[model samples]
Target: MSETYLIDRATVLTMDGATGATPVERSIRVHDGEIVAVAGALDPQPDDVVLSGRDRLVVPGYVNAHTHSWEALFRARLDNLPLEHWMLLSYPVLGLAPLSPDLIRLRSQLVAIESLRNGVTTLVDDVLEIPGQTEDQLAAVFEAYRDSGIRANISGHVMDRPFADHFPFLADALDADLRRQLDAVTVVRGDEYLDYARGSAQRYADYAGGRLRFMLGPSAPQRCSPDLLAGIDEIAATYDLEFHIHVLETRTQAVTGAEFYGKTMVEYLDALGVLNERVTMAHGIWVTDSDVEVLADRRASVSHNPISNLKLGSGIAPWRKYLDAGVNLGIGTDGMSSSDTARMSEAVKAAALLHKVTGPDYRQWPTAQEVLTAGTLGGARSARLGDTVGSVEVGKRADLVFYDMNSLAFTPRNKPELHLVYSENGSSIDTVMVDGRIVVRDGRVTSVDERAVLDELQARGPELRRWQDELETLNRALLPAFDRQYASVMARQVAVDRYSGRGECWLN
Candidate 1:
């Protein structure tokens, strides 16, 4: 017997295309963790909890298709570096001591709190457990999501191969002692990763009332050995799990593919039978036209992180090209280090405007409707949860957000979707419901003590900064090598250019 809730007289934007595009004043009836009805009038019953929705604009909650919740503590700490160098600082090839389970829970809880407050009800987090994963740490993360009242699908981000293999010229660039140190760094074996993944799936399959799920995170193809990739593909098939990996995030990565396999990363995955509908590639910035076709044919999705791409100096992805190819596109705020925040409104706004500069052809640009769909439904599809959430439909989960129309962002609102895409920055988010539970209201999360978590974060800041400073100092030795490789990759002629200002364009 699930609790019932009636949200009455709200202006709803059901992104469900089965329904019409018009925003209608409707009453939403939720029960049994699903929306039972959306009609013009749904009267409150004796057992129904009535929520006043007058002057509220209701829509499907945003789905963050790709993010790293583990890096919440490192938000805004890394800046002004390209993907290759920045990764070294963030992941630290030289391993640091692992974080305690309590700290992990605190960080994860903060991610959920911030996400719920910002109208994001679902998160696809590629959780990177530093130094390696442990059962206690995994449980801490799972417990945090379970307690926070937000829907989350997490992957234990894994990289089985050595550090030197992914880069194009790092092995040659490093000094002998540096090379020796890199070789000495221990990595989790492929078989161990597979075992852990299997065990984790079995352990957490029914966690958080099925709101918390697990996906396979290979980190990236280049970071995994061929056998490891094959093993992951096998595990995914056996368990029916979704796959998430970073692909061609930078020119350096593109060059690595050419240097390593004489093909693009997408082609490499396709060759290995890893490219399929179950896969979602993050930051596909430098894929070629053929690669786009391959992605479309495979029915794979791309989580476009425009803000992160811009911040990392990773080139803009071909948004128009991806759309034209009929590829499923989703928007993501990425991780804290690159995007600095988990606000999907900012990400959607960036996705809406970033492609206009791709060309002067105005018709090819994405509309407000397309971006909104990508932010909600497309992301849900990317996470393999399309049928469950992402829309305010009759049978979908009750993951909806209510925005105050009286807010300044919607003042004189001519077009609600346009204003949502352009003017609103999540400050208008008044109420957020996930799985039929009102977790956020009046700009605060109800599931957790946000003030205590924030205060704990501040209390632990000195230690975190000390660790971060030590990691930064240790990783600085490889900067010159990574810079050389980045320059080399940029100088080489790639098959396609995704950069906004890569070469000269002369008018005909």
Candidate 2:
């Protein structure tokens, strides 16, 4: 049995759906990785560890609802590029550098520590699998999470469609050699991926004191074939797993869905019979009112990546519409390369402020409290861990973040939620505990050699970028063709527009 711990006199923001709205002073007790008692605690064990919670704001640990942790190695390296250029040009080059289990593990370790430092206790890693990587390489990822003392849910990203086919006019516009090159990109069968999923689920289902979970990840709606999407849904049902997929992220994607399926991707998923409660769609930026209704009707959740959406020039999500429609809204940081940071605080703040410009009506703006809920409980729902770790309750796991209320971010401390969402950017996060264990203290990780990890990465990152010249050569060769394709996609008017200045062209 583990020793009990007491967090005394904390200004606890329970983050529990039942009690998160109002912050209260209370003491919390934890034993065996679960929060046992939450208030009016009378007795204390002789061996118990009592921690002073004064000057601290104890909230539920932040959840990185959606992430591509493997991209941590290349974080911020491809900044200043939109999603189109990032995916089509910058990222594909990483495929040519090198593949090693050590690199994967190191990257995962780096991301896990970064999350903890930013007050995140859990991560939903939409791990973009490097093609032809062995199971051992994948195991290294899980091992790093376990060793880092952070909870993580991992899924190997599945994408069968060639990169050339992901766009509308790319194949037709590219030269024969470039077309052949893109078409020859790595491919894998749907069944093979499911087979791997089954084995992976069993292999690491209970790692890190039962903190690891494996899920099915379809890369996206248009990038995945119908057979693969349906097959993935079936496999999820058979195994009782959650599926994470990207949908309607960019305006161009809205066009792709209509051109590919004669409807929105949301409707296509519904028709394909895969739109259900177990699905978590990331970035529903261009979703129509009808699409929101469909998602709500299916009881699905959407991972709101506000910072990433803004950074990539993807339009703002109709979060107010989604809330009114009763769709579960979870906040996420997307990928390290996408947002260049995995800080939930930044995402929460962006969600609170970015939607204000959509209209002047103040009644529909996202509330700071709501964004806080999304960063906590809503994220748990997205990760399918709602029952276990989202909230601070008697039966829930003890995943708590200790923010310094004494910091400059909270100097006056008049409005905790408002200041948290609009001002703080994780500089106030002093310590974080996961599963009742003190994994982080005084802004340093307690369980891993973080400096050594940094050293290894610095030593190895240059080698991975050894093919920069070759990548530049290839990008130059394809940029013009890709530029044409981009223009064609952008010009192909869709039935809806989610951007601010690009409202529908009235033809009536």
> Taking the tens digit of each residue's C-alpha lDDT, what string does model 2 give over 1-508?
3968888888888877666846778789989889999994436668679888888888998888888886686666676656877774445633364457787889899998889988899899988755644687778888899889898888877887877778777777889988777666677777787788778777766767678888889999888889999888987887667799999998778878888889989999999999998999999888878898999999999999988888788887888888989999899999887888888888888888888888888897888778988999998988888988878889999999988999999988887777778878888888888988889989899979999999998887677576544665566677777678778887787766677723443221
Which whole-number lDDT from 0 to 100 does residue 241 have in model 1?
A: 76
Query: What would the TM-scores of all predictions be?
Result: 0.97, 0.96
Residues 18-40, model 1: lDDT tens digits: 65335788899999889999998
- The TM-score that candidate 1 achieves is 0.97
Cα displacement (angstroms), candidate 2, residue 246, comes to 0.8
Q: List the residue pairs that clash in candidate 2.
A: none
RMSD values for the candidates in order, in angstroms, are 2.1, 2.0
TM-score of model 2 vs. true structure = 0.96
Q: What is the C-alpha local distance difference test score of candidate 1? A: 0.88
